[model samples]
Target: MRADARKNHDHLLAVAGTAIAEQGVDVSLRDVARRADVGLATLLRHFPTREALLDALLRTRFDELTARAGELETSSPSEDALVSWLRDCVACAHEYRGVTALMAAALEDAESALHASCVAMRAAGARLLTRAQAAGTARTDIDGTDLFALVAALAWLSDQTSLAPRADHLFDVVAGAILTSAGNSATGTTAPRPRP
Candidate 1:
């Protein structure tokens, strides 16, 4: 793509991503185009279908998130890094209210881009888990699948009006199960739980 075209594409994706997060999957191409200050024809040229557009935006978000997790993977205190990544993941998940719904709808259709992105995300997440587990701070029983479920729940809670503000509480509850530091329990702060 030309430089201007690429800029337009990036701008459209950013606008659409935020719109979808705030307005749910029903947001119109017109709104995205308007936010990006681009014409409808340009938006259509970039994304032929709403589902296709959503899939692209979802992948883009996941890609950025994966990079962020990877960047922090080697940080000291593996447990902190993992928990931090989990918190960030929830933020990324909430960027769109019905993101999980969109993924579900698209995943049902085999050979879809959504399916491909899901696979990629799973692998990336697993790698992070492996690193944390290697550091002997994460529970052996808990795997990437478990983490995925946690993120799903967090995202769902984030989409809810009543649960949104307390979303961090939900994450704290889940993190309480994973972090470990019984020795520092004296401080009375929510210390990490035992890994074993």
Candidate 2:
């Protein structure tokens, strides 16, 4: 891509990220174009479809979360790393309203633009979960898919006006359920401490 075109693409993605953060993943393409001070055609040239645009905007965040999981895997205790990564995943999903549904759908749809990124992010969390389970800190009954579902569920709870206040409390409850007594002791609590 030429320098000018790359600039436009970056600008459009930046604008789109803000728009999606303020409004939702369902925000209109025209609105994003208008916000970026670009023609719809220009935006389309960079991102052929809404999914493409979203893929570009969210892929970076997904990659970051994946990398973060890897870092935590070696630096933190197995249970701490899993809980921290779980919290971060939920927070990322909740950052852009309505993204949780898209992520969940994309995870199952191989053809979806976001599928690869979502899969990578899920795998990162799964590794953390596996490590915890191996350490006897997490439940063996659940798998990576279950952890992914819990993230979506926790994020969905934050999106609900009535349940938003209880989301944190519910997260603790779910975390406690996932951890064994030994895992709970490792974290110094049944509900692991919040990430700093």
Candidate 3:
């Protein structure tokens, strides 16, 4: 890409990021172009599609979260690494409204623009979960898919106006359920109660 085109692409992405943060993943392409002071054609030239645009915007974040998992894996205890990565993943998913659904869908759709990034992110968390489980800190029943679902669920909860306040507490509740007594003690979480 030429310098000027690259500049425009970066500007459009920056504007799109703010728009998506304020509005959501569903924010209109025209609105993003308008906000960026660019024509729709120019935006399309750079991104081609909304998914492409989002793929570009979110790929970096996904990579960072993946790298963070690797870092935590080496630096933190197994349980701590898993829990910390879960928290970070949830927070990242919550950053852009409506992204959780897209991520969930993308994870299953190999052709989706976001598929690779989402898979890598899930794998990163899965590695952390596996490490913790191997150490007998996390539950043996749940797999990486369950952890990914929990993240989507937590992000969805945060998206709800009515349930937003309870998201954090619920995150702990879910996290506790994923962790065993030893995991709970390490993370300062209590075991979840059995349902009646």
User: How far off is residue 89 in model 1, in Å?
Assistant: 0.9
- Give the residue spans of candidate 2 off by over 4 A: 185-188, 191-196
Q: Rank the candidates by lDDT, best first.
A: 2, 3, 1
Query: lDDT tens string, model 1, 1-196?
Result: 9998888888888899888877988998899889888788989999988877987788877777777677777654566667777777788778787777666555456777787766556566677777766766565577777787788788899888887898877677677665545322212236555534
lDDT minimum window of 10 residues, candidate 2: 187-196
Instruction: Give the 10-residue window scoring lowest on summed lDDT in candidate 1.
Output: 180-189
TM-score of 3: 0.93
Tens digits of per-residue lDDT, candidate 3, 1-196, equal 9998888889998999999988999999999999999899999999999999999999988999999999999999888888889999888888899899899899989999889989999999999999998998888888889899999999889988999999988888888888887788655787753332
- What's the TM-score of every candidate structure? 0.82, 0.91, 0.93
Instruction: Flag clash pairs in model 2.
Output: none
lDDT of 2 by residue, 82-134 (tens): 99999999999999889999998999899998899999999999999999989
Model 2 earns a TM-score of 0.91
| 1 against 3, candidate with superior TM-score | 3
Ranking of all predicted structures according to TM-score, beginning with the best and ending with the worst? 3, 2, 1
lDDT scores in order: 0.73, 0.90, 0.89
For candidate 3, give the lDDT of residue 177: 88
